[model samples]
Target: MYEDFGEILINGGNRGLGLGFVKQLLSQAPQKIFATYRSAETAKELLELATNNPRVLIPILADSTCEEDVSNVAKMVSQETNKLDLVINCVGYLHNAEHGPEKSLRQINANQLLESAKMNALPTLLLAKYFQKLLKHDQPSVFSAISA
Candidate 1:
């Protein structure tokens, strides 16, 4: 699918499946790669992996729930690449510790559900909205998310 390469933007590429995608994409020799991470510190490993690779770039910070963050990423991507071939929204989180996942139907509070929806769903919607211009006429401009 990536045979004729162009820039690809990956949100939440700090680790796990996102990181794997970045690593494999790097091997494809795309024109450029823009990966986002919530915490720069958490992305050190990935940063190091792409340290000497000129084709990789990490410009967006991971805050998919924030409109400002998403907008800024879109702008940055537009400035860096003429077109986006693929956009992979890999931002997600399972409630942790004090706010772990709601197990029972009765335990599903408004706050928990809202938080999950924001983390799991909203970003993709926002990304499509903000990046619509950049995706124009680009056939197979993929937008994907990994959900549990």
Candidate 2:
């Protein structure tokens, strides 16, 4: 069903698991890829990958929490291609300097929980809200996410 699939969007695809997904997708030699990062200067690994695969990889600076960034990216993608075959959301806000996942109910804090929820939830919702139309509906299209 995905024989026509080519254009792909990877959010938060700068480092760690997100970067790993970028590598895996590159190995498949897709027609085009749009990878988003909050800060381009800090995404050295992604930048290197894009350098090595300039034609297939396109790095975009975007903050998942920011609606304007997401909307702007949608416009950019619209300029590049009419539709995307897949959208993979890899942004995770699972921890902050103040705290992390608690082992027990008592160990958890309201602030950390809210922070984690915002990070994990906001991006996914914003992506769909802004980019859903960019995905082909008649043909096979996929929206997926990763977290820990």
Candidate 3:
């Protein structure tokens, strides 16, 4: 399926399964792979990949949870390409230094829950809102949100 794609976008492509996808898809001959990373400090590997394959990989600094960033990313992508063949949203928030899996109902903090929702759910909505235009095509295109 990926062989048919000329352009693709991968959110949270700095590490984990997102990074794995980036590595695997490099062999698929896509013209461009727009990969979003949260920060340079955490995105060294992704940056190196972009540097090594400048023509194929683009490392965009963005926070998927931020609507403004998501909007800006779509605008930036629009400037480069008229259409995206595939969009793989791999961003997710499970736990951090301040929060972990709630062991019981009493442990569920409202603020933590909101934070989780912001990262886990809001990005997909914002991506669809801002990038729906880019995904439209006579051929097949996809906007996939993978929650993990």
Candidate 4:
């Protein structure tokens, strides 16, 4: 499917499944791919890919949970490419070093719940809101999200 990918955006592409998607997409020979990461320190592999494939792979530092950041990323992309062929929201947070899912009803915390929702649920809407301008309204422009 990515054989014809002109310009693609993959949110949270620093690690895990997102990382896999980035690698696989590269193998599929996409024209240009924008991969977002929250920190450079944790994005060594992604950075390496960006460095090796300078003309095709671009690693962007962005926090998907932040609306302003998302908007800024879209602006940056607009500077490079006027249209986006695909957008895949791979952002999700079920657990981290400081927290994990509640094993029981009593273990849930307000902050954790909000954090999960912000990362997992809001990215698709926010990306769409800010990047719709970069999409081709008259042609095939795909927007998608992955959940587990």
Candidate 5:
């Protein structure tokens, strides 16, 4: 998939599995990579990893839940590049510190479920909504979400 150089964007790329995906994708030698993290401080490792790698671009302080943040990122991508080959949405929230879904109907709370849906599902739809124009007409484009 990385044979032909192209731009890729990844959200929620501070740590864990999102970081792993960035590492593997870097190995493929894409033309450019724009990785967004919710907190700039949490992206120190990613910043260190990007040193000496010109293709890697770290755009910090983007919260997927915010409309302004999403719009800013879309604008940034449009100004800097002509086409976006891939956009991967890796943002999600598990219920509290327990780090798992509600065990039963009794445990479910409307607030928690709503938060989960907003974090896990809404961003993907939002990304598509904002950046659909950057996607090529003939060339294939991919929008994916990773959730727990």
Candidate 6:
């Protein structure tokens, strides 16, 4: 099934899980791998990988939570190919230095919850909305979204 895959998109390629997917998928020899990262500072590894494999890998700078960024990414991908064989969304927000994991109901702050939703939940929906056209081929396609 993977051998026939022509194009693939990975949303959170800077993270370990997403980067692993990109590395493994390279074996399949897909025509293009569109990997999105929020910031250049955090995406050094991904940028390096892209530098090594320029023809196969394309690193895009995009903030998944922003609708405009997502839309622009879709447009950019469309310029390369009309169809995407697989899309893996690994952008998840569990906790940061300021906000740790909630241990109990009382620990669940409203703002943190909203921030979690924005990071963990919203990106996948927005990606689906904008990239649906690229995923609508006659062949089998997959869109997998990982959560926090």
TM-score of 6: 0.95
User: Where does model 5 exceed 4 Å of error?
Assistant: 98-100
TM-score of every candidate = 0.89, 0.89, 0.94, 0.90, 0.89, 0.95
Provide the overall lDDT of each model, using Cα atoms, as 2-decimal numbers: 0.80, 0.86, 0.91, 0.88, 0.78, 0.91
Error of 2 at 82 (Å): 0.6
Model 2 agreement with the true structure over 1-148: per-residue lDDT tens digits: 3335588999988987788878888888788889999987779999999999987899999998888999999998888989899999999856667786688889878877777888888889999999889884678899888877
Q: Give the TM-score of candidate 2.
A: 0.89
Candidate 3 accuracy as TM-score: 0.94
Provide the lDDT at 122 for model 2: 84
Model 3 agreement with the true structure over 10-68: per-residue lDDT tens digits? 99999987898899899888899999999999899999999999879998999999989
Error of 5 at 50 (Å): 2.8
lDDT by residue (83-146, candidate 1, tens digit) is: 7878888888776666877678888788778888998999988889888787776466777778
Query: Is 3 or 4 the stronger prediction by lDDT?
Result: 3
Q: What lDDT tens digits, residue by residue, belong to model 5 across residues 1-148?
A: 6655377888887787777778888889777777888876888877877775754665556898888899999888778888888888888766668546777788877877787888888888888888888876578887778887
Q: Pick the candidate with the highest lDDT.
A: 6
Each candidate's clash count: 2, 0, 0, 0, 0, 0
- Judge candidate 4 against the unseen true structure and give its global Cα lDDT, from 0 to 1: 0.88
In model 2, the Cα lDDT at residue 147 comes to 76
* Higher-ranked by lDDT: 5 or 6: 6
In terms of lDDT, which candidate is stronger, 1 or 4?
A: 4
TM-score, prediction 4 = 0.90
Writing each residue's lDDT as its tens digit, candidate 6 over 51-130 gives 99988999999999999999999999999999999999999867988999999998989998999999999899999999
Error of 4 at 8 (Å): 0.3
In model 4, which residue pairs have backbone atoms overlapping below 3 Å? none
Pairs with steric clashes in candidate 5: none
